[model samples]
Target: MDRTLLEGLFRHAVAQAQPALAIERHLPAPPKGRTVVIGAGKASAQMAQAFEKAWPGEISGLVVTRYGYRAECERIDIVEAAHPVPDAAGEVAAQRLLELVSGLSEDDLVVALISGGGSSLLPAPAQGLTLADEQAINRALLASGAPIGVMNLIRNQFSTIKGGRLAAAAAPARVATLVVSDVPGDDPALVASGPTLPLRGGRAEARRLAALYRLDLPEAAQRLLASEDNLPPEETDAVFANNSVATIASAALSLEAAAEMARGAGLEAAILSDSIEGEARDVAQVHAALAREIATRNRPFPKPVVLLSGGETTVTLRGTGRGGRNGEFLLSLAIALDGVDGVSALAGDTDGIDGSEDNAGAFVDGTTARRMREAGIDPQAALANNDAYGAFEAIGELFKTGPTGTNVNDFRAIVIR
Candidate 1:
């Protein structure tokens, strides 16, 4: 298998989902009054730039993005903040964005650019909860191995800007949200905790998720979620009737691009699913099983075939080791393959960062496990300690693509030849 081709496929997937390419066509026409753009996410800055380039007249607003992911924009202000975890910078940005949209008229337009990582980029803690409290809960949820949807639900419950409150603030004004979906199912409400969309399952559902994940919330956060006083006000149907959303990019679309790239390389390609989710190691074991079957028996497709999948997978930290779901999945898959010939795979996050690490993910071939063992590294021990980053780095298999500026979650491609 050609590692270059495999890496190229991943790049193609990300390029296909970039905000500059995806956002232009989906942009709505200018409203009768001022157009105020507000957004948050990994792609928010680039999305803002795209909007500015295509708009006929001047537009002013603010957008927050993950630190180091900011793109240049003239009219729209782009602010940098932390991601996958909230920070003080994000908190400040979120507060200012709410003020920007407040007191708008019916003719005004609120163009919201929402995407993956927005939940963290826009952290407006609810009353009685401080930034520290929200950060504590966020860290717990990330370590709890909960799905993105469940985690976002808990985030929305504690946020004043999320759970449709942003849209509510723009009550009389029309809200047009342009989204780049990074979650499975592409549910608008789940993307960036749906700042401009209605909450799917309210506080009750959020409480249920916390209980299910066994997350211990801070005292203030606990009381806030339990209280109904801070709940979002119910808006008339007309308010929502004026709002609209357009999904410019998504995991499914990126997966299809990868499939097309595979076919172009003269290999048969199969997309298992775009919404596969669960524990990283578990999902990897399943993919390994299918790859083994195809390699040994050609049961699913002939040799020279690639299997692809995308979605967010969770990692439950137990061993206090360097971790990222993509790296963990690749390491686990390599272990499961156990030196099976003619098999190579790549797993990466489209946003070009995995967990808190610098590397996007990693690559592994049939010899990966053997090489690790020969290098005096025990793959099993490393995996047991949740140190996939260490294991892959030892064998020079780590993949690093700095700040892709777009995210649609994890991308996995297994090539069997």
Candidate 2:
């Protein structure tokens, strides 16, 4: 029953961020000329479908989402591609997107449905850079423990359709961007590297960050980062004259919904934060401390309370791990909370994936570690090898949600009773 309740909190967070529920309310009016919709993200396909149903006039366009994340659409075309790592399919789609937005006039409208994962789903390598170059750098950044903002900034430098380049191509055509923000600050400019929004940093900033993180970029990627030509256009450029952006859904809003759900269930609830970011294991330790405090002394909150938080966390790969950030977080948390009674927790990526695994995340209580030990699994050893997924899988404690069709970031909840 505690597991069910904890999962309920996560579901509430995810449901609140659904594009179908939020997109129509934020959409711009239909244009007098052509209305072209172009989007990329885990939620873009659903956004297109919702927009299609809401529009009163003719509309046509394309959107790209992660493979197997495709949603059915009639007027707008939905394309599936690789995520976290761009692919040949994404490269072809990126080229096509630039062409679609070009040759348009002020009478036309470019509706950009942007969200997290869009940055990777549209992998248009900039001039002199190849898709392979982008992919290698993207992989490196993911494992470097760099924050999402820095990662996106670096990716923006290597893309032909990001950092306001997409909107620039639609010059003379008004752009209306609706976003599902997944970054720490909910900066629409950082969502999917701000493909339709002008994010003002350039090659210099990217190079500085790359050096700071010791990123190993391919020769072409390194050269591109060092070149003056790789900088994004100025924010005051005329290309952005008639553009507008709206954050339709975000981590803060999602966390609020989860908190409300807890309250509705007659539990006193508190939201710790909606924008925490750092190494996953480190963040888990902080969360465990909070949970321990509430459970042992009830100083922060009374018993029968649930604490909720939302944000993206990073994983610096040190071992041959087979799990994502949330998995790493849960394993560390379980170890810290071991044998502490009446405290249970759940952490999941709202998009229904916790790293590369099928599980959204996992569930844990004070008994989690002891249970693992009983099953002849050393929890600490598994975490050391970055094998949290394997540990949880061996015990059938994995939490799987196929695809929630939306993304607001990570949803974490701790229940103490």
Summing lDDT over every window of 10 consecutive residues in candidate 2, give the lowest-scoring window.
224-233
How many backbone clashes does every candidate have? 0, 0
Q: Tens digits of per-residue lDDT for model 1 on 1-417?
A: 469988999999999999889777887878899999999999888899888999887699999999999899999999999978899999999999999999999889999999899988888888788999989988999899999999987888888998889998897999999999999989887899889997677678888889889998999988887777577544354667888999999989999999998999899999999988899999999999999999999977898899999999999988978969999999899999987999999999999999999999999888999999998889999988999999989989899999998888889999999
lDDT of 2 by residue, 7-107 (tens): 98898889999988987788797788999999999888888888899888889899999998889999898998898888999998888889999999999
* Top-scoring candidate (lDDT): 1
Distance (Å) between predicted and true CA of 257, model 1? 1.1
Cα error, candidate 1, residue 64 (Å):
0.3
Q: After superposition, how far is residue 61 of candidate 2 from its true place, in Å?
A: 0.3
TM-score of each candidate? 0.98, 0.98
Q: Which stretches of candidate 2 lie over 4 Å from their true place?
A: none
lDDT of model 1, residue 380 = 91
